[model samples]
Target chain A: MDKFNVGKHISGKFNEELEAVRNKVLAMGGLVEKQLADALSAIENSDVELAERVLSSDYKINQLELEIDEQCTRIIAKRQPTASDLRLVLAIIKTISDLERIGDEAERLAHVAKASFNKDQEHLLVSLENLGQQVLMMLREVLDAFARMDEEAALQVHQMDTNADRQYEALTRQLMTYMMEDSRSIPKIMDVMWSARSLERIGDRCQNISEYIIYFVRGKDVRHISREAMEDTVRGAKS
Target chain B: MDKFNVGKHISGKFNEELEAVRNKVLAMGGLVEKQLADALSAIENSDVELAERVLSSDYKINQLELEIDEQCTRIIAKRQPTASDLRLVLAIIKTISDLERIGDEAERLAHVAKASFNKDQEHLLVSLENLGQQVLMMLREVLDAFARMDEEAALQVHQMDTNADRQYEALTRQLMTYMMEDSRSIPKIMDVMWSARSLERIGDRCQNISEYIIYFVRGKDVRHISREAMEDTVRGAKS
Candidate 1:
C-alpha cells in the first residue's frame, strides 16, 4: 500500500507544507492510538493512576488537533489547493477532528477506570475489555488505511465496526442482567456501561475516519450509503 | 448580527454556490431541531408514533449532511476559496457533521420513547425533559449564531451548555438512586438514563457548533481552549 503522495503541486513550497500537514496528522493519530490503548489497560486493571495519566494526557491530543487544524487552514489560505490536493487537506482536517474525539472518548473510559467500586467485578470488566480491544484494533487499522490511502483496508474497518457494535450490544444486555441480579452492583455496573458506550462511540468515530479515507482516495461520498452499497462501490472501484 | 459574507471571491457563481450551501445547512439544521423537539415530546408523553416519526426523519438529516458535505467539497474544488472564505466552507462542513450527530442522539432518544415501559415514570422524565429543552435551546441559538455569525450569541450558547451538563450529571445520579431503591425498575430507569446521556451528547455537539461559529466569525480556533481563555480572547477581539 503506497502512501498517497501530496507533493504533486506545482509549487515546491506548497508541496512541502502539505506533506508537513500529513506528517502532523499521522503524529496526532499515533498519540490518539496510544491514548486508547492506555485507557483500555487502565480499565482492565482498574489502575487509577494510569487512568489519571490518560485523562491528563488528553490535553496533548487536543493541542495536536488544534495545531493540525491551523496548519490545514493556513495551507488552504496560502496555497489554494484544488482537486485532489484540496480533498487531501479537507480529509486531514476531518480525520483529525475524529481523532481528537476518539481521544475524548478514551478520556471518558479512563474516568470510568478511575471510579472506585466496592467489589472487584471481574465479570463485568470482561465484555468491556473485549469491546475496547475490538475498537482499538479498528482505530489502528483505520489510521493505517488513512496513512496508506488504502480503500480496501478502509473498507475492512467498516466490517470490523459492525462486529464492535454487536459486542457492545451484548455487553449492555449482560450489564442489565447483572444489575437485575444484584441491585447493589448497579452503580458500579453503570460505570462499566458508560465506558462500554464510550468504546462503541470510538468504533463509530473510527468508521467515520475510514469513510473519510475512502472519500479522499476514490473521490466518492460513501457516507449515508448502505453498508452493502458502500462495499459494492468499493469492490467496483477495485475492479 | 450580520451574516458572514462569502461573495468577495470576484466570482458571482462562487458566491451563489456558497449561499446555496449555507441555505442547505440551515435547512438541515431546521430538520434536526424538529427531530429533537419531537423526540423530546415523545419521551415526555411516551408517544410511540411521534417517536417513530423522529426516527424516520433522521434519514433526511443524514441525507442533508451528505449533500452539504458534497457541496462544500465542490465549492473548494471549483472556487479555491482563500482566507475567511475557505474557513467559512470548512466551518460549514464541520457544522453539518455536528448537526448530523445531534440528529443521531435524537434518534436514540426516540427509540427510548418507543420502548414500552411498565409505568409512566414521570419522575425520571422530568430531568430528561429539562436537559432536552436546554439542549434544544442551545441548538437553536447556535444555529442562529452561525447563520448570523453572531459571536455574542455563540458565546451565550457555551454558557447554556454548561447548565445542560450540570442537569445531566444530576439526572444520572438520580437515576442511579432510583435503580438502587427498586431493582425491578432498573431496566426502565436505564432507558431514561440512556436518553439523558443522548441529550448530554447533543449539548456537547451544540457546543462544538458554537465553537465553529466563533472560529468563522473571529478566525480563531477556540476549540480545546479553556472557557476563560476563549472568553478573554473573544473580549480582546471585541475591544
Candidate 2:
C-alpha cells in the first residue's frame, strides 16, 4: 500500500477505538433502559423483589459510568482526536451523565413503588405505564441515533420529548384531581405522580442526549432553539 | 524578555481570556443570586410589584446564559486549550447551564408568590421564608467558590445543599401535616410548597455546579462519591 493508504489504515484504527467507546456507552444505556422498564413493571405488578433489584443495580450503572468516563479520558489523552472525534467524545461524556441520572430516577420510582406496594394501591398505575412506555421509546430512538450517527433521527427524538412532557403534565393534573376529589387517594396518587415525573425527567434527558448528537455532528448548539427552528436547521443542512 | 518570559506572556494572555469568562459567569451568578433574594422578599412581604419585575427580568438572565455559552464555544473553537484551560471552559459551560436553570426556578417561585398575593393567605408563608433563607445561603456559597475558585469552599457548598434539602423535606412534611389536619390550608399550602420546591431545586443545581468545579480543578469525577469521600479526595490532592 502507498504511504497515504497506510496513514488511512492508522486512522481507521483510531475510529475503531472510538467505536469501542460508543459500544460501551450503548451497553450501559441498554442496562439503564432495562432498569427503567423493570422499575415501571415492578410498580405496575407490585413486585417488591424487582423493585429492590432495580434500586441495588444502580451502583452497577454508576460504576459503568465511571469506567466509561475513565476510558474516554485515556482515549483522548492518547489519540488527541480532532473535529468529529472530539465531538463524539464530548457527546459520550454528556450522554453518560444523562443516563446515570435516568438510572437514579428509575431507582427513585422503584422506591416509591415499594412504599406503595404495602398499601396495595393500583389506581394510577396504567397512566404510569403509558408514560414509561413513552420514555422507553425515546430512549430507543436516542440509542438508534447514536448507533447510526443520524442527526435527523436525533432531532425527531427531541420533538417526541416535548409530547412526552405534555403527557406527563396531563397525568399529574389527572392524579391531582383524583386526590382532590377524594382525600383517601392522596398517598397512592402522589406515588403515581412522582412516577410520572420520573418518566418525564427520563424523556427530557433523552432529548438532552439527542441535542448532544446534533452538537457532535454539526458543531452547533441546538439546545436553546425551538423545535421548528431546529428542524429547519437540520433540514437545511441535510439538503 | 527571555524565552521563558515569552512562555509566560502567552500564558498571561490565556489567563486574561479565562478571567474574562470567569468574570462574566460571576456577573451572571450575581444577577440570579439577587433574583433569588428578591423572589424570597417578594413572597415574604407580598410585594406584587417586585414579583412582576422578577418575572420580567428572567428574559435577561436567559440572554446572559446564551451569550456566555457562545463565548465559551468561540474560545474552545479558537484556542483549543488543553488541560486546565479545557477544564475551565467545561466548567463554565456546566455552570452556565446551572445558572440558567436557577433563573427559571426563581421565576417559578415568583409566580407562586404573585398568586399568593391575590389569595389573601399569609399563614403558610413563614416556612417558605425559612426554606428560602437556607437556599439563599447555598447560592452564596456557590458564587463564593466561583469567585475564589476555591475547591474546599465549593465542597462546603455541596455539603450545605444537603442541609437545604433536609429543610425542604421538613417543610413539605409540615405542609402535608397541615393539609391533613385542615383541608382549609390546602390551596395556600400547595402554592407555598411549590415555592419551597423551587428553592430546593436551586440548592440541588448549585450542588451540581460545585461538583463540576471540583472535577474541573482536580480532573476527577466526584459525582457518585459520598460527600465525605469527595472531601477526602480534595484534601488528598491538595496535600
Best by DockQ: 1
Q: Report the C-alpha lDDT of model 2 over A105-137, residue by residue, as the tens digit.
A: 999898976875334356678668777888899
The positional error of residue B11 in candidate 2, measured at the CA in angstroms, is 4.8
> In candidate 1, which residue pairs clash?
none
The segments of candidate 1 whose C-alpha lies over 4 angstroms from its true place after superposition are A1-3, A118-120, B1-3, B6-9, B120-122
Q: How close is candidate 1 to the true structure, as a TM-score?
A: 0.96
- Which has the greatest lDDT? 1
Model 1: per-residue lDDT, tens digit, B131-214? 888889999999888888888888889878879999999899989998888777887898899898899989989889989888
Estimate, for each residue in A95-174, the C-alpha lDDT of model 1 and write its tens digit: 99999999999998888888876555766776687888899999999999888888899999988988999999999988
Query: In order, what lDDT does every prediction score?
Result: 0.86, 0.79
Model 1 whole-model lDDT (C-alpha atoms): 0.86
TM-scores, each model vs. reference = 0.96, 0.89
Clashes of each: 0, 0
